[model samples]
Target chain A: MTPIHAPDVLISEVGPRDGLQSVSGTMSTAAKCLWIDALAAAGLREIEVASFVPPKLLPQMADAAQVVQHALRHTHITVMALVPNLRGAETALRSGARKITLPISASQAHCLANVRKTREDMVAELRAVVALRDAIAPGVPVEAAISTAFGCTLQGQVPEDDVLRLAVACAEAGASDVGLSDTTGMGNPAQTTRLFKRLFQEIGERTGAAHMHNTRGLGLANCLAAYEVGVRTFDSSLGGLGGCPYAPGASGNVVTEDLVFMFEAMGVSTGIDWPTLMAAREPLKAGLPGETLYGMTPEAGLPKGWRG
Target chain B: MTPIHAPDVLISEVGPRDGLQSVSGTMSTAAKCLWIDALAAAGLREIEVASFVPPKLLPQMADAAQVVQHALRHTHITVMALVPNLRGAETALRSGARKITLPISASQAHCLANVRKTREDMVAELRAVVALRDAIAPGVPVEAAISTAFGCTLQGQVPEDDVLRLAVACAEAGASDVGLSDTTGMGNPAQTTRLFKRLFQEIGERTGAAHMHNTRGLGLANCLAAYEVGVRTFDSSLGGLGGCPYAPGASGNVVTEDLVFMFEAMGVSTGIDWPTLMAAREPLKAGLPGETLYGMTPEAGLPKGWRG
Candidate 1:
């Protein structure tokens, strides 16, 4: 199959949701809104603003509805939220989320640990969530992000067949899109390319973002391998804020600044204003004091004659 | 040209040389010998042991001759040293270094700043050094490492043609091999692949190790790109020591642990025993009390079921 080289790639910012959720401190709703607005202004077309879950369980995302309400004001950006079940999906849709992602673990152990349900049970929950979306919010799109699609910290070595089977189940369950995630960051570039190529072959147009972690320092390499196999949308975080609780000492998502620099330097436009995207980090830093923000490009400055 | 997929790729450890040279702390010859012994025990076949430079200029490498002599005790490991000129090359050969690498900056500004000489003057120096190796130490191999081959902090955007021309000059100057060094860590994978492919076309089998830095966090990605283009022999530092002094805030050489993990996970053999290689870091840490060490694989541990 020929590799798809798109003129522009979509960099979906997930810092507010994924970045904040994993950290200890809770960002204020107002601070979250400012961060979201800065991201939007930096030409990010998609932003996963919040996750719909009980405030008691995750106080970090307690202001999910408020954050979503504010993010929806930027009509140009796709306001996204994470949902665990039908109730969360309903809440997300009601809060004006254009996109809702449901995470289904390919590894049974991770599935049990993360959502307190079996993989089959999670698929059933996804089916219910999709049904609710179609019934009450037919226009809103629900995407199933297959977590531990690469490997699992609990079970380890999640088979490719299991991941493909789960993805097919999600597609068959009325979900609009399916994405593969390296939740444990146990992916090598070769494995990333092979799995993503198979994903495109199986799910075709339903294949979505590549959510790779920098836990083992293969995040960007894995992303590049996926891109080489025609996967365009990439999920990344500003400052690489979120760490993998499963993989000790492993960093969080791929840093957005470095990713943008890679694509832009290669002559592939990400449509992000370089200076503006970098400026967005200021508010993020202000909101999360004492948190160690990680990004190489921001620290190293741009290369000589770099206009991006 | 077909990409070379060697059963075993050489991991040329540059920690004792590049790692020590860049950092402020000076490691004693005894500590250096312990680190070298551990590296050899880990199955590393080759290591850049030290730099043959004036002690007054770099007190970090004051025991260069002692380090090289101690490293030579391991008959299985090839002792290598960096040489800046014919004088250093002679010193390295007399000290029983099997291999000597001379760095030639591709960027004129970097060449001036690093060695206080123009590019043309450096080419002349390489010629003299190669001649000295041929005359005095006929068995010792000489390699010219084109530093800042990617780009430069002082003179950003080193032209591809200039780099190719320099490689040709070094090859013509009787250097046994010519390698590319991302001295400023300004390389992306695309540029890396493009440049290395061109190098093979120009120099053929004379193309040597790819010395990539983890400065902008694209070190492993850049190495993968070079490997994909048929280049073999990677130069990396244990625990990711040796930051680019030219590029502020840039990290160090590609982490040896992370690089090994990448290739080993992809079914590419690195020969080095995983646990033994990680154990080598203990000596490195003990030698430098306050210096910061880096490597994701050491921190994250090995993936489940990893035998190597």
Candidate 2:
């Protein structure tokens, strides 16, 4: 085994939860386990195995518990799951998720459209999840991922004040960590730096990962801005999956390969096996044949003499 | 006309020169002029109109003088051109190019391959071009674009020392400014920040634009790193033109549309009108009928209610 040491950055993989959920097809439980195994073998320290949502709503995550259990077997990898409310949180805890993310939209319109709840309702839901985590899984961290913190498709120009207010509300409501999500891919570098800086100022250590998208092609830049502002954890997907279903050709989350490549090239340690990470794509593609996978690094291949 | 004011950053369009040079097809002269007009109408302050290489070598730029002359008509825009040697520089000056860029590679192999000259020879060429400028075009600025400043496909991992030394050599040779170019798209954000920082340390205000590529999909992130280190001018293409022809689908230059969107969304004024910029893509597509055009902001459309 490789020597254990904290990496310069943590690129948390969300493909299983976010990528699979965004796609139309449901992968078999066996393929899911294999894909998760490949990612873990590639040295990913954290992997969001699945979202504990109703299988009727998102059939792709029907085997969330089994996926979580398989991922939990890799003690070195922190297993994560997404939850909507108390019930999902309870399921995630029972499945042995080490970390749980609760998506709470900063935009009222998006929150109402996404979960049939307003921002206030999301806050209440976050509180309920936090309480459930404390009682059932005391050590598991509950992350409030503030979606559409930059701008919204339903409403334009999400006020920075509202985002900060929601972040503070989440922290006060007992979230172990509060993160920003550019759910609509409308964030800019300045806004990212400003928001994250404010996050640190208000919530201190509770500031969490930056879940950015490449929809407008500023995903890496936004992540760089967050890193400059001291954000260590990042949420990305394999092959850049999970695009907004309504927006055609919209790149989903920032590609995990690209993000790790950036960090490694910058002389920052990511603790990932680059070749193994790239090879993991084979299982990813095999898991869901005929599904379109997107990533510049994989398509472009590695540059000549890339040590990674 | 909108009020004339300095934008926070200068995004110099390089499609007509770099874009056309890399593509196999030769766009008509009329198409070039019309595309330039569309870009000017979009409020880009500077645009590299053409490259003054011999027609036999690069037939796409055969109409360099005419293109430069046409772009010069827009008094508000600073028309620029690329040159490889003193002969090309002389032709560029005669064509009334307001600014000129001479691509000098920091990697010895790239320098030898690109210009059949060593880095030392390129420095001599820069000196000759500067001398000619002092005689024929006293006011025009000559930019020395240090391509492969970060890394090279031919000789991977271009030393940071070489890039800084070349920048100083150009500046001392009377070059107006020296810029860094990730021609091979092997640049990392940290390397970019480090190299640019060193360039500024050695040759303060003489530092110039960041000519980055999205070969590995970190173009915008690298640009952000340079911007963070006080770079204000950036070179990009309308449709991300001029990729390394050897590598298929390696995104060429940073897309001007996406780069402009990044700066604009950051509230850092690029002075580029958003809708007008998107509209400019129509002329670009028309100019190159069968040629592929690439950009995210163009395909994704504006996010709900973008002010630009």
Candidate 3:
């Protein structure tokens, strides 16, 4: 009924979009809404509810607009969507999403494979998306995330200089905020800390979330590295959903529950109830039956009297 | 073979002792030797080869002396053993252990549950062990690990002042080094960094290894926090072998393979060969048939051209 104090850190839940898209089977539109509503009920202030991609390309997200519409009902949540280009951006804007995130690959090989666009081409597309958003839904923040900014499976070691240059390009192209993503989960804490420090030096307050992956089990550590260097926003998925489905035992975003546990346990406010956050996993499992959910906290449970 | 440069960090392999003892089924003595040989061949310089305990308490460690003898054959490795008290220490010293580690629980509740001794009683036991070591093996190091120094399962939060006081007591009792152990995996990075910092201030160079567990999935993060605060030695179980079996999905030490990967990828010299370390798991699995081996780096193959 009343306003809750803003959490010391902002954890944007990207499970519905990133997790669902990576899976082969499509979760029903109603089930996705239920999951999204469950995440918001657990006190997540932001949720990337959908991705506006064509049905033919990704049938998992064919009901993206409906998911966005349903999530918009949570007045306390900033409903966000991801887009690959200006066309998807137009659709996302019309769907009444409050925030938009555009993915631009730092590794040229990954960019070409995912979107068939060069780095320069993607930046130009980002500029176009920002312009379109200004013309229609003014004040809707557009964020650019540099994917594979840590390293790429194709390129092996992504150059740090290249990542910094591309981040500046996103900022110059009018992205309200720019973030670094370990899309391949090849990042180490040292690199995560260094890159974020350099990103802040280059872009100042324009730096956004640290979207780390647990592919190598260093996700939470990398988040700690980023936080030590002044990162305040993080993007994680519920149940450690989504990943390079191509690689066995690899997953995309860090588990939201575990990340929340690490920060909240350390006396950092995440504004989410630990028990309630753990309970939200049921809706996710219900929506996507038989999927192997990953998270040590969920499996091990919290320490005795962790809340007390 | 020419001498290899010492690694920047030391990874003390504790699986043969901690991991084997926790499981219900016993690994054959020959199999334990084979596993220890593999770990040494992979460049692990120190291995906690066995726990010198009574056969009735843990049949898995029934062949403690034989395993320690086999591990000693490596010559390069510091064959360490865990001793509960003066009796185990006398046997371990007679068997030629290069180092001895005594577990002194910081939490009174854990101390009572584990050794049926109070914290002060454990400190007195440690003093006796150190005295015996000096008479029989003067040069050998006697380390005391303050388990549950971070938090305890039976008794909610363990006070920081209490942990610091225990470390001081261990140092005063002639522990060659005093380290912190997150026996319950309830530690967070902030708590880890703060506690280790205070420990360093109190004991200086006497600070020992950080034995972090992955129960709540913050193991690596906690290790990083300790490392950042100047604690170098780390205790880990290969494949995350040991854990709290009472709680489903709970785990013990940080996975050595993944810990090696984190440091190596960050350009920190672990001195251990990555591929060889991964291969070592085969012998462990062979030894403990049907046991679930855990590690993400082994599950997700290394990044392309990571060696290059």
Candidate 4:
């Protein structure tokens, strides 16, 4: 792999998409746009603006296309959108998303339950999506997110070999990068270290961002484990939002403020400032009132004399 | 260090001392004892039960002696207490604490502001405490916890040499072990890795627990970094309780439930079951009404099919 000038870690904020979606009240399209702009001003280089899923399925994401278009206006940051399947991918590309994330569940049961498809079928769908993206938008990055790469709640104890197989399959199917997700937040540091090591070893540099849930509270720990093993880009929802609906109150994604705080405070250039990013929360909270937001950094106030 | 059976990691629950003290309300002695017992029942081996400061200083910890007595009932678990000075050490010994932790601030400004003593004076106090513990309870462990080991909120960017010197001085002063604390919560994974590596290299096996906070939200990230470099015994709080009075909300120690979940999910044998441990939250939360209780594992329901 070429030595990238980017710092050792990259915290990709998924608040606009994962976080907002989990919130009960919907943010106005204008509000969403403001939050995105605020985040960019806060020095976040990458942000998952929205998912191109069916608006009927998730009304909260009804204005995703508009958000993506606005995010694309700021060319400095990479604009990412989540695509549940081929149709979602098409919507994301049409809306000008430079990067499209495809979710492929590692657990067949989760694949069946979450998106109503078997694991193999999802892989085939991802292959089709990869082909479609390559044909329609060649330079655009295509990521096959192997969801539940860590143990899954639907199907307990996903085999490491199975996760690796799906990752290889995703790569073979033409994904530009293969990411891993701890959909259930059941990851531990040892498992995190071992799995990421195996992933990097087997998949080589094809490993992508770690899309982890804070459900079991290992979000940051799992992220650190991934970082230690050479995975840089991490997908975290602001306020730790976007928990599994099946697990209410669990949807809090690893709070972006906290995640950025964790990385930046340690002197890792996440390219984010805690105070500025924390200030961004006001717009977000304004967008979706009556939401139960969570994050220790913003509430705790910055350490004694902490700087950006 | 003896070659004892090293389970994947060590999670020291600091909710009683570090977690509760950070919050505004004080848990009743009975409530504190109940929570400590619940944590011990959940397979926590080491727990920081209470601080030994004077009642006049931290009224929340006035019932420290009673809590200590309650924690001592569990033979399998080791009871630890925090002390700010020699007087506190005296209190700790009288309470029959098996482990006494002294916070020795690395930042001179933090030392003066926090403990009202200089780093050198803290070291002298640690020496005296060690002597007291040795004389009164030979088998009891005495640890000098170097706070702001990574950086300080009061004095930004504490010198590495200063931290190392403090650790060395504490060891020379007869401390049984030396621990590092991110008092200001200004720790990142890389810095955590480097600081721990340096401490272990400088202090060798004398290095103790990784005392961290979620202030800037890198608690687990820092913990993982420490674990990667061979440091064991992480200090955490149950429900991520305990906000520092001085640094309101800044005291959310690493959440114990989340820490255990992270470890156990990684197959690290924390000997803690998430469900049972989470059950302790209700009682803990009920003890302090209106206080914000923080914990990912408690809020996020356990993953679908976890055995432990």
Candidate 5:
């Protein structure tokens, strides 16, 4: 439990969702549930089990509803899923996800190039999704993940003003919280602190999870920068899964093991045990045999006398 | 250059000294020069070039004199060397090193275990070394690094009072600066911030670099916490080389390539280019073939269209 004075940091494992989405192989829904159970047993309070996008777009997530159903069995853990628009959000709600993340690209160029939607159009679509979620799961939380918040591959540098504007619109359009993502893994500590501070100050308490990439290896450091300024929730993929196809080796989200290691080792009480968290990696690697897994904690093991 | 009022973070590469001391292989003089040159080319301004300990203790650093001589060829970088006592300090002074670090283990157990000296005895030994450096190299900067600032494997739960007292003694004993180290890789972010804040407030401008270990995987996060509370310099090993023999995989220092990637990608201006930095990893790895290298940046390529 978080003390009123110093709230505990929330490490949300995105391995099952974001991690699997970018990989080549498909993990059976049962294997994913086992992985999710392992993560929750290790004390991860939230897990992004899968995304609700159409199977045609993401065949790996064909059984999103099944994964969500299994994840809901562990009532203590908050089950989250990614949704692109109204249809995906509707699917996620039906699958019993308590939280749905709508990825809204902050860069128009990236939104058009990747999602085939303009920034304004994405927000307009989100309004309907938010309405749909309210109708189905009235108390469910809706998050607008502002992808490419730091910079983008297609657009280069994402202007800070554009990020803030989208954040405001997301909140106004009914997103319960807004997140910042280094979709291309281009964030530095200085830029991270600047942008996150601006978002919190401008948007008040609506700032959400810090979705960072390990591409440039700044993922953990960038996350720390965000945490220093009041971001409690963090998104990380296991084994540093999902390399940016454009930047090979950069796709893994910040390795969940490493992030948990950082918080737990620092005596910050991340509620994760090094041994149990590390044990979860085996299932992840077993599910994706040929894919190269990235992370140092698993290979190096935890330092001696580390408390959970 | 950091913008006015923006946070300034320093990347102190300790590959040549702390890194090589632990590995079994002796790097060819040419490989050392190439690695140091490559690091400088990648915008790493401060690097610990070599240790001045006796060759019998660490044959890997046998080429310290030659390595330091070669590093001097690059006028833009700051070359530092580690010295165990006055003898090593004298050797470092003879080699034209402008910066010298004297390791003083804060944990009495680590001091006796690592340097074969008692805490009081080491402080007395350091006072003499400081005097020797002042007489031999008047203008050269000498820093006393207080190791095991957080916790110790040998003693466990190092008293914060011991760390603070050692910091005061080092400064009072003629040291130009004082630094803290988590030699056992047991530091946490909250403890890091509190310790740094206490040290800075007590010693003010005398605080120096943060030498951390990635053994438990919180090195970068601890560095971020220190930076938040006003620590400016950070020490990292190249290829994440160097760990305590007692702590398996604790041998890797926080990898220089990954640390640089973290800072640069955040647009924090490490001044290091990704390609050049990645290219440097080859020499580091080539020097020790069987030794496992740890780092996220080199394994994962930089994000696409990365500006720096």
Candidate 6:
């Protein structure tokens, strides 16, 4: 198969949303804004700034609206937010999120454990959220992220048919884009390529980012596999912040620095300045003291005379 | 390009020689044999048991001869040792090593720093080693490993032409096989595919293992790229041991457990039993107390239905 050599790939930063939500420490609204600013300065075009969940349920994201408002100041960067339901979608719209992502677990077991909803129930909620988004802010793009799309810890081997059926359902329900996520980091390169190629075939341009984890150390491999099969958009966390709590011993999301390095080294433009992106880690480390940050590119430094 | 679909891949474990050599702690000869036995039991057919360097230089490998002798007990497994020169090669042959690997740095600067010899000087030594091997034990295979073949830490951007030229020189010098190593871990998937494809074109079947590092977290990605280009043999360190001392902040070699996981998940047989391979880590950990061992597969555990 011909490898998809995109001129540039969009690296959507999900550390603030997916990362912070999983960690015990809560980054203050100001720290979140500073981190977002640093990320934007490093040439990131899109960032999932926060999740619109109830503060009581996820107190870490209590200042989601505030973080979103601050992020909106950088008009060039697309501010994205995670919305669980119509209520979350309404809050995200009010907060001026340019794009809202709704995570729908492809694995029924994971769906129940994570959101306490059945796959069918989540799809209905997605349709309602899509309708609400259209009614309130037609400009905002609503994306349905199929988490546990590859496989699941609670429920292994999420059928490809089920994943495709869900993707079709989400697209039919008015999702602007539907992305696949390796929630349990159970994806291999071959499986990733096959699944994503199918998704692209089934939904065409509605196919979105490949959200992989460094858990199994196949994050970059899986991403490369997806890239080879024509997937361009990737979701990563700064310093690999968010580990899947459900998947025990799994690492955080693929680190953005390392991801940029991989693409840039391969002559794929990510629009990210390597040194600047690396410099942003300082503020991130400051925000999460004693919290371990992981990325090999930063630790190994750049290759001699390298430029992004 | 058509991907190489090998039915079975050879995973040459390099932890004992490469890993223990770099780390500060010296695993006892008894411990080395036990670790090697555990590895062989896990179905690793080829293992670089020790490096025949001066004990004064590397106290960690002072018992190289003893380790090699012990390793040779496993007649079913190929006992390999690393030799720097003809003297080391002679010692390796006497110790009953089935195969001996001589590392010839592609980067002139790295060659000087590592072995205190120029590239040409090292090639001359390699020729002498090959002559010595043929004279003493024609049955024993002598491999010339082109270190920093991908890129260098001190002198970056080792030209592909330089790598090919060196490989030709080594092959002409009587090496049975010549392999490329990402010594500084400054390799990407694209570079890996291009270089290995060229190596296969120039040397044909003489092209050998892809020795990559997890330094920038592209180890498996680079390996996969090489695999796509028809390189089947892979060199990995169990527990991801052996970081490049010259390559600042570089992580250990590609974790064998993780590599096996990737290939097995893709239905590529490595002949290694997954659980048994993971169990091998216990003895390794016991040997190197307080020394950090790395491998995502061991940490993340096996996938739900994974067998070997």
Off by over 4 Å in 2: A1-4, A244-251, B1-4, B244-251
Per-residue lDDT over B206-301 for candidate 4, one digit per residue giving the tens place of the 0 to 100 score = 999898876666777777778878987898877777763113446647778667766665556676655668777777877888876666566666
Q: Quality of candidate 4's docking, in CAPRI categories? A: medium
> What is the per-residue lDDT of model 1 for residues B2-66, given as tens digits with 9 covering 90 to 100?
11443468889998998888887888888899999999988888899999999999998989999
lDDT of candidate 6 over B1-308, digit per residue (tens): 01145338899999999888778778888888899999999989899999999989988888999988888888899999999988999999988999999999999999999999999998999899988888889889889999999888788788899999999999998888999999878999999988998898888988989999878888999999998899989999998887542135644698898899899888788888877898899999898888777777777787774531
Q: In candidate 4 chain B, where is summed lDDT lowest over 10 consecutive residues?
A: B243-252
Winner on DockQ (1 vs 5): 1
TM-score of chain A of 2: 0.95
TM accuracy, model 1: 0.95
| lDDT (C-alpha, whole model) for all candidates | 0.86, 0.87, 0.88, 0.78, 0.80, 0.87
Cα error, residue B120 of model 6, in Å, equals 2.2
Query: Lowest-scoring 10 consecutive residues by lDDT in candidate 1 chain A?
Result: A243-252
Residue pairs with colliding backbones in model 6 are A242-A252
Candidate 2, residue A259: the lDDT equals 88
Name the candidate that leads on lDDT. 3
Q: State the DockQ, from 0 to 1, for candidate 5.
A: 0.43
Candidate 3 collision pairs: none
**Candidate 3 residues B1-308, lDDT tens each?**
11267677899999999888777668999999999999999999989999998989888888888888888999999999999988999999989999999999999999999999999999999999999988999999999999999889889899999999999999999999998999888999999999989989999999999998888888899989988998889999998888542134455679998888888887777778777888899999998888878877887878876867
**iRMSD (1 decimal) for each model:** 3.0, 2.9, 2.9, 3.8, 4.1, 3.2
Model 3 CAPRI quality: medium
> Mind giving the per-residue lDDT tens digits that candidate 5 earns over B1-308?
32354335678899788887767677888888988998988778889999987888888787888888889888878889999888888988899887889999889988998889888887888889878877888888899999989888767788888899999988888788899998877787788898899899888898899887776556777777887788888899777777532134445477777666665554455656567777788887776677767665566556566654
Q: Per-residue lDDT of A107-145 in model 4, one digit per residue for the tens?
A: 888888889998788888888887888778878888888
Instruction: Flag the better candidate by lDDT, 2 or 4.
Output: 2
- TM-scores of chain A, one for each prediction: 0.95, 0.95, 0.96, 0.93, 0.94, 0.95
| Fnat per model, in the order shown | 0.60, 0.74, 0.77, 0.78, 0.55, 0.69
Task: Candidate 3: list runs displaced more than 4 Å.
Answer: A1-4, A243-249, B1-4, B243-249
Write down the C-alpha DockQ for each prediction.
0.52, 0.62, 0.63, 0.52, 0.43, 0.53
